[model samples]
Target: MSQVIGTVLSALGRLGMIGAIMAAFGVGLAGTIYLSLRSPEVEVPDIVSKDRFDGEATLRDSGLNVRIRASRYKADAKPGTILDQSPRAGEVVKVGQTIAVVLSREPKEGEAPAGRDEDADDAANAESSRGGSSDTNKNDNQNRNQRSKNVNRNTVNKNANKNTANQNAGNRNANTNRIANRNANVANRNNNQNTNNRNAVRNIANVNRRAPTPATTPANPAGNRP
Candidate 1:
């Protein structure tokens, strides 16, 4: 009976030791699972949005890195927006992996953009103003060309009139010279005729005076001698 009691005590001690070992193993396994499920904590570096950041340089200056991953087709989002992200916005995550983003493309044909209609109207008005100015300049140039033609014609007419006046003056001077020469010739001829007439008259008078009483004495001498 004493040997049986001692054997039973030894077996009970071994069973207790085994139960303690199993419990320790179970606790270690549970701790490992908890550690695997937990995420490493990291700060949300920065968030970039069009209205909030306003400038590309400003967004880049922040610690967060941006990468365009997708595109949206709106004219207003025309600026673009932050659509989806990994590690989700507020949750902690490892650094250096780029946060994917999206950008907006140019507007479509008929799509209207958000904001003032005045900008579009202003562009149209400016184009119209430029067209009007070009037309005015062309008309002004044409008028200037016509004025130049008129001035040239006037200059030609003035030159022609001057030439004609000079020619008429030369003709008048020639006529005067001919008249003076004819008058001079007539005076010389009249002077020569007057001189000839006077010489002939003087010769006739001298001939009459010099004709002597001819031979009257010859008849008287013949009667006396008989």
Candidate 2:
């Protein structure tokens, strides 16, 4: 009986020692896990405008993880370039914290180029200026044509009026000449009629003087002799 009790007690004692050792090991493991969970804080670096691969490498070197929040088209930035970051540079964060970043991509088809709006406006203004000048020249040509037409019309009218006045003067002179010729014809007819009447009166007077003297002397002598 005494030997059996000794064996049982020794076995019990060994079991208690093993339990204690196991408990100690468990506590040490728990402490190590808690310490590891509490990581050191670090400052965020400036990775904007860097290449995506280079930025990721930089973040890894700083004991940080990267998260691509979005991608967008950029005219000036190269494709796969890092354009922005959250929890910006110099901000303190825990190690292994994730950084959100925006990456650049090529512009889609039909997208306009950046910084060219002013050039387009300048071109449009130049075209408008040329159009205005062309319109002005057209208007000037029209005015010149109208003025020339007016001058030609006035010249034609002046020539017509001068011809009419000359025709009227010619008609008046012709009428005056006709009246003078008619008066001269009337005067010549009157002079010829007066000369014919005087010649007839002298012939009658000569015949009577030559025939009456003989007849009157014979009558007076016969009256005295009978």
Candidate 3:
């Protein structure tokens, strides 16, 4: 029993030593990873100005976020050129720390120039509208004139037809009068001829009446006795 108890105690001591070594190794590995993640940097060389460095990309590459606090202008540096930074360029900031940037616009000109362009576009549209209205009015006048001319032409045609009809009726009346005159003359001439025929017949009958009547005897034997 004493031998078995001693063997168990030795095994427990070996297990505790192994756990301690594993814990130490884990702590050392965590420290090495933290140091490796904090990449070293050189003072930005003079050739590459701090202003031109892409702080946004640099921050994101280091697993950091970007936040903007405030912005200011400096004439010596280009408008967009970073005049100053929150965490100076090479500071060892935590992975989640943010970097902010400032953008630039034309200093002298603002939205007024855009407004002027809009006004110019509006003026152009107004002029075009006026021109369109003028064209529409001209077309309307021309159409009205054409309609008037058509109406005149139709009226003229109607008048001409009326005059032609009147002339035809007059000609028909004249022809009827001429035919009536011809028929009256022919009737008078036929009546005169009939009268002359009746007179001649009467004269012939009178002459026959004035002529002597022959006396009839009984017979040839009777003529010797007379």
Candidate 1, superposed: residue stretches over 4 Å from native: 1-132, 202-226
- Of 1 and 2, the candidate ahead on lDDT is 2
Model 3 residue 50 distance off true place after TM-score fit, in angstroms: 45
**Model 1 lDDT per residue over 1-226, tens place:** 9999999999998999999999999999988667655634455443434532343333345444555655544454545544333333554544333455444556668866533454344334433533444567789999999999999999999999999999999999999999999999999899888888888888899998998977755566556774
Could you give the candidate ranking by lDDT, starting with the highest?
2, 3, 1
Q: What value of lDDT does candidate 1 attain over all alpha carbons?
A: 0.61
Residue 192, candidate 3: C-alpha displacement in angstroms: 2.0
lDDT of 2 by residue, 1-226 (tens): 9999999999999999999999999999999788668878999999989999999999999999998876767688899998777667887888988888778888888875444564344334433533444566889999999999999999999999999999999989888888878887787777777777777887888778777554554457556665
RMSD of each: 37.3, 39.2, 31.2
Models 1 onward score TM values of: 0.38, 0.36, 0.38
Best by lDDT: 2
Per residue, candidate 3 scores C-alpha lDDT tens digits across 1-226 of 9999999999999999999999999999999888867745433211112443465665556676655543333334464454334444554555565554343323553332224454344434433533444567889999999999999999999999999999999999999999999999999999999999999999999999999999985568545654
Collision count of model 2: 0
Which portions of model 3 show Cα errors greater than 4 Å?
1-132, 214-226
